[model samples]
Target: MGYFLLSRLLSAAVVVLGVACLVFLLIHFIPGDPVEVILGEGARPADREALRQALGLDRPLLVQLSQFLQGLAQLDLGTSLYSQRPVMELLAERLPATVELALAALLVAILIAFPLGVLAAVRRGTIWDRAASAFALLGVSVPNFWLGPMLILIFSIGLGWFPVSGRAGLSSLVLPALTLGSALAAILSRMVRAALLEVLGEDYIRTAKAKGLSARRVIWWHGLRNALLPLITVLGLQLGALLGGAVITEVVFSWPGIGQLTIESIQRRDYPVVQGCVLLISLTYVAVNTLTDLIYGWADPRVRLGIGE
Candidate 1:
């Protein structure tokens, strides 16, 4: 187990390093110049050059990349080109909102998915199963971009049940959370149903049933407990996905999260901010996946040998 964890951590570090280098190289290749954006086209040549020099934009690309990597090693994300604020500070301001939205979406997915999945699997051929299946299909089909606007139109504009945009309170969180979570719920429901159905057919489950245990006990304890291994894997990975998906959702809702910050930085050619945001997201995604692998090993010790290799 220790060897498995150490290997996973090393691999995670390597992935993060690759992501950092890739983001730095790609952002530099973008067409617009941050200096040009910061100083209007009509600005004097000396003025533009001075501003560029001050922002370290005049340095060679390799020099800048080296400096950026060095800063990262010390947990310094550098200052934003446009804002003149520390990139890490800006990220700190926005990280919580993104985290809140992502966790809320995860909660929404779990609430909707579990019972529906269990019912559908338990009553395999009935209308309940059909309804659950249809819901999952529809959820998967609807894209967040469209669903976000339609939800705003219905719940925020027409009925006036929720705020249209921005984070204010719990009521303001509902629409964005729903928009982000609906698809996850659909996918998760199907996974749960499938996992549970397979577990239900196991010999141990049949033995539990034959022992005259209550149906609820047989399903929830015997069947569902075993089914949880796969469910945990999905939930862990999807939590990371929810953060990435929040980019689009945040834009639609005008929510003040890192995703929105990232979009604004891109539009303004704020390279440091954009790079910081992507690095943060990539780090988070890698970290969540690594933790998921560790949890998988913990849940089933037999899996640790495979994981360590």
Candidate 2:
């Protein structure tokens, strides 16, 4: 396990370096003048030159990259051109909101999707199963923008149950969390159902039934336990996607999360902020993926012995 973990860590470092290079090259290739964006109009040539020099834009690309890497070593990303605040500080401020929202959505998805899927699989060919299927279809079909507004209308405007937008307390979190979780739940339900169906047909399940174990215990423990391997994998991938996808829900709800900050910075072509945000999101995605790989071992003991490999 130690060797395995060390290999994973080393590989992750290589991937992070590749990601940094890709983002750096892509951003520089984008057509724009950071100095002009920062200095504003009617500035004299000398002033523009000074600003460019101050921001390190006047340096050669290699020199700039070296300096950036050096700063990265010291955990410095420079201050934002617009906000004049450290990139790390801004990220630290906004990280909690995004973490809270993403975690809420994931919890809701698991709480709802797993049981629905299990029920559908256990009660196959019945109305309950059909209902779960239909729910999945509807979830995959609806656009988040439309769903968000409908939620705002019914829950916030019509029923007076929740706020229309903005994150404040528990009441404010519901609509956005549901808005994000609903679609995820739908997808998860389908995945879970399929996983359960496959696991149910295995020889061990038949033996358990033949052994006269209670149906509930057989399905919930024997069946669900084995079925969870695939669900765990998908959960990691989907959670990563959800982190990026929340940009829309965050914007609509006026939630002060990293996604909103990314959009605003992109519009103004704020390079440092954009880079920091993208890097953070990438780090989150890869970290989740690493966790997923680790989960396979816990979910199934044979995973370490090349059984799942």
TM-scores of the models, in the order given:
0.97, 0.91
The weakest ten consecutive residues by lDDT in model 2 span 300-309
Q: Which ten residues in a row have the lowest lDDT in candidate 1?
A: 300-309
Per-residue CA lDDT of candidate 2, range 1-309, in tens? 665666777888888778876776777778878777777777899999988888778889888777776777688876787888999999999999998999999988889999999899988889999999999999889877788999999989999999988888999998888888888999999998899999999999999999999999999999998888888898999899888888888888888999999888877777888888888888899889888877766566676556645
- Give the distance in Å from residue 272's predicted Cα in candidate 1 to where it truly belongs: 0.5
Off by over 4 Å in 2: 210-212, 298-302, 307-309
- lDDT for 124 in candidate 1 is 100
Give the runs in model 1 whose Cα sits over 4 Å from its true position.
307-309
Q: What are the C-alpha RMSDs, in order, of all predicted structures?
A: 1.4, 2.2
Model 1, position 163: C-alpha lDDT score: 96
Task: List, residue by residue over 31-55, the lDDT tens digit for candidate 1.
Answer: 9988878887888899988999998
Compared with the true structure, model 2 gives a TM-score of 0.91
